[model samples]
Target: MKQGLEPAARFAADLAAVWPEDERSGSLGLAVSGGPDSLALLLLAHAAMPGRIAVASIDHGLRPEAAGEVALVERVSGERGIPFTPITVKVAPGNVQARAREARYAALAQWARAQGLGAVATAHHADDQAETLLMRLNRGSGLAGLAGVRSRSTIEDSETILLRPLLGWRRVELAEVVAAAGITPAYDPSNANADFDRVRIRQALAEADWLDPVQLAASAANLAEGWQALSWYAELDWHEMVMRDPDAHGGLGFTYCANVPRVIAIETLLRIIGELGGHATRGEAARAWERLWAGENASLGGVLAVPSVERVEKVGVAMRVWRFRPEPPRSAGH
Candidate 1:
């Protein structure tokens, strides 16, 4: 019942609506980076759910200041009697931002598993969602991509779920929460760097008079609903119109009737490819569908689709079937 803890309580209620009450009964992992947003989350989560939270800060080792930031978060967590763990991750040699993100989540997931925590929460706010939407739109993303960052997602291949409870709050609101808590948060210099696409988009959105973060986030939520509806129907179609090809020898595969809708066909193919240890991008799936419709064989991303005829017993009819299979691996020299 602290004076500045109202926002945290409000967010706690918001999280409760999404998460089961039993799930929140256990200790939750909070990803605190000591930035204004994460720091605010640390304070708010502490106020809302006392004695049920542990904190961790990831040091990507990209900058010298990262260690100090982790130290700051550790101190804050210690002062509140919360368990604190600091993790250092080595970034791989590609796409610094993306690699760092992957490493960060991996480390967090590992730490959370060790601690027996159920879910890890981050401080992605409305502005972050807006920036993500704008970036995906600029890249010509489809409906699923345009849905932007989800509020809850499984961390890669890990069972640990990621929760973003602050997506409904704005950046400025988080700053206000930090100020009200009388805590000084560390700032990362790279947030203002124009070399990063997200930073540039954030700057542009700041200068625009008509654009609002809340509205942009709402649009993303609407698109997420649309994406969900598509997925629902896709799964329905998968169950109704597709079946496993039991006679396949090389790898597991599926077959669908030629009369299936294009969207359903593409979704079913993508699901099959995913199940067979391969991935097909949206464009690849669409092109494969076009090839199947034209009665041509197509192969991409280690999956192959070809047209075949199946004889129906007792019906005396040869029905067209689109057979999908995983491609055989190439030799080293090839």
Candidate 2:
């Protein structure tokens, strides 16, 4: 029991630290994927804080056996005497996985709000943290992108907080926990698709002798420390200097919010790119930002060119915003 409880104790400590504040009723929501990662979380959470927790699973309905998987989760929850709720999601086309993830969290948030849950916990381990950092690096993300997924946060306009309990644990440790508990863990098939960037990373890591889970977990911890310092500085600047208008220039106005540190600028730009129906990478933010600073950022599609219209006239005094979309794609007949 001590060995089995090792990883669980560490994870539970992380959760309790991030979620120290108690709610009126002291209820917590658990996001279960039916994998060892989350199953372990359920078991550990039970051991760590016995009375205040409940479970919820989001079924993205993409896989053929997804509903069966949900049933398995319910069975496990029932066996453990935990209350469970399953939310089914219909994923949209184009970037299906990302959309599915967003919908899953949104559903969880709604469900938690309804249940009067104070915080929602997930089993995002250290390996996932490293992968996200690498992905953001490959995408030319800036510091905030490099900072990776947060361990604790709240969804916008919601009372429920997100707590990642296993951010310090490795996948190897989790596998051991599952084995010790005599549980069968479900693997997410989407994790192996070669077409996805993250899967490519996983495959590359698998072939390396030095890519042991422990080493990867250590490296991720280092990255997280660096990211924490960078994020602290960024938050200071964001609150003090940046101004944002969601509707400005069809959301390209997020560019004008770049008055403070470059970190806030990039985060705001990330939000803007999503609003503009385009995926903006860190490189993309740098590209757009360079133009904005030099007075040559393209000024089309209700997007503003910061400073002024006339290059010579008090450059920083006049702010110019225009609505310009790149020429529409040609029709099939054309």
Top candidate (lDDT): 1
RMSD of 2: 5.7
For candidate 2, report its TM-score. Answer: 0.75
**lDDT tens digits, residue span 1-334, model 2:** 3235565576666676677645335577888888888888887787777777899888888887777778777888888788899889888887887888788888888998888887888888878876776677788765555656677777656657888867777777777877887889788887779999989987776677575544555565566667777667666654643344445345333423245455555555544455555565666666676676565745333233343343223245444332223334568999
RMSD of 1: 3.2
TM-score of each: 0.90, 0.75
Q: TM-score of the candidate numbered 1?
A: 0.90
Q: Candidate 2, 227: how far from true, in Å?
A: 5.6
> Tens digits of per-residue lDDT for model 1 on 1-334?
3235578678788677656677654588999999999998898889988898999999999999999999999999999999999999999999999999999999999998999997899999899999999999999888888998888777997999888888788899899988997888999999999999999999999999699987899899899888888899888877766778855354578777655567666777788778767897888998988987778998867877788777755345787678777787788999
lDDT of each: 0.85, 0.68
Best by TM-score: 1
